[model samples]
Target: MILELNDVLTENESHTLSFMASSGELMCITGGTAASRTRWLLAIQGFSHISHGYVCIDGEPLTERTAQSFRELMAYAPERLTTLGEVTKYEPPTVQDVFSLKANRDIPISNGILGEEMRRTGADVSDGRVQLLAVAVLLDKKILLVDNPPKETSGYLKNLAKQGKVVVVTSDEDEIISAADQVVEI
Candidate 1:
């Protein structure tokens, strides 16, 4: 799968970015707070619109009719409660709480999976780290977009990229930035 942003304009920023990411690539979008990386990530994930340029999946333009399907192929961490509405199931669900969601009822979840992934990544087994990795495992989304995960989890993010997943992250951590195959600064 491929994600391409052709001269895409931001909703608030006075800048435009053009980038292309393919499967097995780890891309990071970085800039000061003014960069509005979250908005860019939302646009890339098909949750919001770009005022200029275009975002496409495998050359197919992202449109209202296609956004839902596009979203199903991706997952975002630090979950967007307002957009997803999954919060209705519970208030600020943790990794364990997530498995209790009706949609996730059938999917197997265990502390071991989280532990092992964290162990492999060498990230501290904190609640924040578990939250990020849970999105990757439970949802099994081909594309992963996340807010600034700790630099220690860089290994797991890279593991996702190695598994042919397009990983786009909004981060300020030096190691995370250095590890990206592509970096777009808004």
Candidate 2:
């Protein structure tokens, strides 16, 4: 991975992150509260503008064409949660129902089975809604990006890391420094 930031941050501020991983190398970003790591995460997913530098995956620059192809692999679970309704299994539809709507019908996992998985993740299945479904979606992604995961959510992050690479961006130096196989100070 290659993260280049020249003027992306506030004036006179520096922003840069770079990581080259082997097959099982786990990389983490730990630094100041300038959101350099967060910006790097966004750029890796082709979400924000890189004013001066470019991000590349496996030597391939994150160009528009490449982004279109790799978009499906990127997933971000922001710190904020938005809910349209407070639903439950006893209501009009269950958590499984919402999951079905979000996921492709052809997927092997059924709504009921996925709902159980949601419950396993500490997400209340009975009154779960779109926000819960969003979690399910993130779990299925190849590259998961989480910002400043608190202690309560660290379990979820650990689970995601087991499934695939979990990129956590935070200013807490200790967390990233000790938790990751390769720690990068941005």
Candidate 3:
């Protein structure tokens, strides 16, 4: 898997950034406000448009036509634990409920896989991280973009990188930065 952002411009200040990341790497994008971090992540995820230049996944330039497909191959785990609509509307919804959502219905989910993700992420059954990671794993997406992830999940992210997945996260935590394979200060 390859994620390349060439001459990309941020929406606010029009700041330019360019980098290329491949599988088996853990990249931390830091040094900015929460909003900026979110914007950068959105840019990479093909949710925000760059004024100049482009983003590429596996050498394919990201455009309106391919944005959805590109996004399907990535997962964004936000900082706050917002309800995932019906997926989390019921009390203590099971992992199967999450995969049952329309956006994730195409991917298969199982009890065994959920157990593994819960253990790997050190997240309890009710934790959103568990749900997010489980979905990302089940989809087998090449990229995992997380915002303000807990420290306990760092090891799990590293393991994902070792498995040839590109893990990019936004954080200001010292330990998280130290553990990253590369740090990009925005």
Candidate 4:
């Protein structure tokens, strides 16, 4: 396994865990209400604080300093959604507004294909944020860390997975589990 965590339990009431991942594999985490699944993923990404245990990526011990580079090789989709530029909900941006960000312009995919992908994701964005995200990950060949993608948004993500590895953090849902090649519980 390229990713592995052993005997990793958290102190904040089941707030920690460990798992394994490898190239060409889609890993999904699922369990009870307080399973600490998200915490495990966050910890792997160096987003969560841990007092014990270790994270090894491709045989190297993961540390605070090395985490940044590892993180750059991955991408995160937060549970909450936001407009790229404007913060207010009232002036909320359409698809174009969020699609025009610096990162979006860097995608290597075709505009038409990317636009179709965004529409399928139900981002309701005409400007193609999801498309850009999908293409960017594909172009960079980075691992993806997605938070609870709605059924409507999963299609695009699934399509992205065909191009790169993905680590999805979901609650006690089985829909995405079927899509995973391996299931790791924390």
Question: Which candidate leads the pack in lDDT?
Answer: 3
Candidate 4, residue 65: CA error in Å? 1.5
lDDT of 3 at 29: 83
- lDDT by residue for model 4 (93-119), tens: 234633465554576567677666556
Task: After superposing candidate 1 on the true structure, give the runs of residues whose Cα lies further than 4 Å from its correct spot.
Answer: 79-106, 127-129
Write the residue-wise lDDT of candidate 1 on 1-186 in tens digits: 998999988666688888999999999988867237777877886655678999999999998988878876876675333334455532223555445545456556577775676566566666565556655555677888877777877777887888999989888888988889888776
Badly placed stretches (over 4 Å) of model 4 are 33-35, 81-114, 120-141, 152-159, 162-164
Every model's Cα RMSD, please? 4.2, 7.9, 4.8, 6.0
**RMSD after Cα superposition, model 4:** 6.0
Number of residue pairs clashing in candidate 4, backbone atoms closer than 3 angstroms, sequence gap of 3 or more or interchain: 1
- Give one digit per residue, the lDDT tens place, for model 2 in 50-91: 666555555576778888555455455444343446543112
Q: Return the TM-score for candidate 3, rounded to 2 decimals.
A: 0.80
Query: Candidate 3 residues 21-118, lDDT tens each?
Result: 78999899888787788788888766666888889988999888898788778876666444446443212234554456566776666778767767
Q: What's the lDDT for all of these models?
A: 0.73, 0.50, 0.75, 0.58
Better of 2 and 4 by TM-score: 4
Model 1 residue 162 CA deviation (Å) reads 1.1
- Which 10-residue span in candidate 2 carries the lowest summed lDDT? 2-11
Worst 10 residues of 1 by lDDT: 83-92
List TM-score per model, in order: 0.80, 0.59, 0.80, 0.65
